[model samples]
Target: MPGRSRPIDKFAAAVGKCSKESAVYGKCILADYNNVHKDKCAAEFMKLKDCYLAAYKKR
Candidate 1:
């Protein structure tokens, strides 16, 4: 049987499902962390946002 889990655990699981997108976005930010400008990572951010939305819907 499936064991009960906490809200945070569920959230983490959903996020884990989108780890690739998250890593891409994270890499974009870290690529220029010191002097990052606006929209510098817009494309990556959009992908991450879409992944999160999809993950949220699946939850």
Candidate 2:
């Protein structure tokens, strides 16, 4: 597989692909950065996770 991306590179690209979702979820967490709790941002987190997985699979 000449020129194939390394796993880490693929993962990084996947993260870049989901930047919007990441930023949104990040903001949600940052709002309560000092006192994070379970499921506080579950919806946003799930959106980011799903985006990442889809992007990763596409690469």
Candidate 3:
């Protein structure tokens, strides 16, 4: 026998699961970037440069 769950309960369960998954992955990636090497992270920071370029282009 099992108990019934509400729709909101199901939705919250799904969101909690995704946040747990994302935190685990984000920590792993950040630790790898901080410990092993920083080149990949450095390149990732270039997205800001692109953002600035796009803003200037739009103006």
Candidate 4:
């Protein structure tokens, strides 16, 4: 794992590749997710996780 990227770095890099506003929105949503309802948060997290996987695949 010497050269492997950390998940946070991968996430930030992926978000960084997005439009500024969208990246900010995504970051904000992630940051505030803990305060949201568990079910809703889990749903949103799954959606974002899928997006992250898609981005990773493209990379």
Candidate 5:
């Protein structure tokens, strides 16, 4: 029989999804800043952290 999934497994899946989405967004934002705006990308990094934390808390 197939094994049941645990809470940690669900949390890991959520975090993985969030990280992938955040990384894509961060890359775009950082690239735009690097090529055009010349502004710091700290916010994007913080956003990734926030996304992971939110997903962790939600699970």
Candidate 6:
């Protein structure tokens, strides 16, 4: 039998949102998910991370 497909992670979903909001930041992070690119979108990513963490804490 085929294995189940897991749902997308919060960070990835956040990245998608960032992409929609800012094409440049989106492309940068998507191309390279390392410290350098992450620093470029630190603010946006931080918001997403906080939101994800909050939701997780509630759960």
- What tens-digit string does per-residue lDDT give for candidate 6 at 1-59? 36643345544554444433465445657766665632687776666566655554443
Please provide, for model 4 over 1-59, each residue's C-alpha lDDT reduced to its tens digit, 9 standing for 90 to 100.
Answer: 79887778877776655554465446767787768554645555565666666666665
Ranking by lDDT: 2, 1, 5, 4, 6, 3
**Global local distance difference test of model 4:** 0.63
The TM-score ranking, best first, is 2, 1, 5, 4, 6, 3
lDDT of 1 at 22: 89
**lDDT agreement of model 1 with the native:** 0.85
Per-candidate Cα lDDT values, in order, are 0.85, 0.93, 0.51, 0.63, 0.70, 0.55
Quote the positional error of residue 23 for candidate 3 in Å: 17
Cα misplacement distance, residue 5 of candidate 4 (Å): 9.0
TM-score for candidate 2, please give it. 0.87
After superposing candidate 3 on the true structure, give the runs of residues whose Cα lies further than 4 Å from its correct spot.
1-40
- State the TM-score for model 4: 0.41
Segments in model 4 whose C-alpha atoms lie over 4 Å from true places: 1-11, 17-40
lDDT of model 1, residue 29: 95
- Whole-model lDDT, model 3: 0.51
Summarize candidate 5's per-residue lDDT along 1-59 as a digit string, tens digits: 37877878877876786867677667867676746454356666667778877777776
Task: Give the residue spans of candidate 5 off by over 4 A.
Answer: 1-11, 19-21, 25-40
The stretch of ten residues in a row with the least summed lDDT in candidate 2 is 1-10
Clashing pairs in 3: none
In candidate 4, residue 3 scores what lDDT?
A: 88
List residue ranges in candidate 1 displaced over 4 A: 1-10
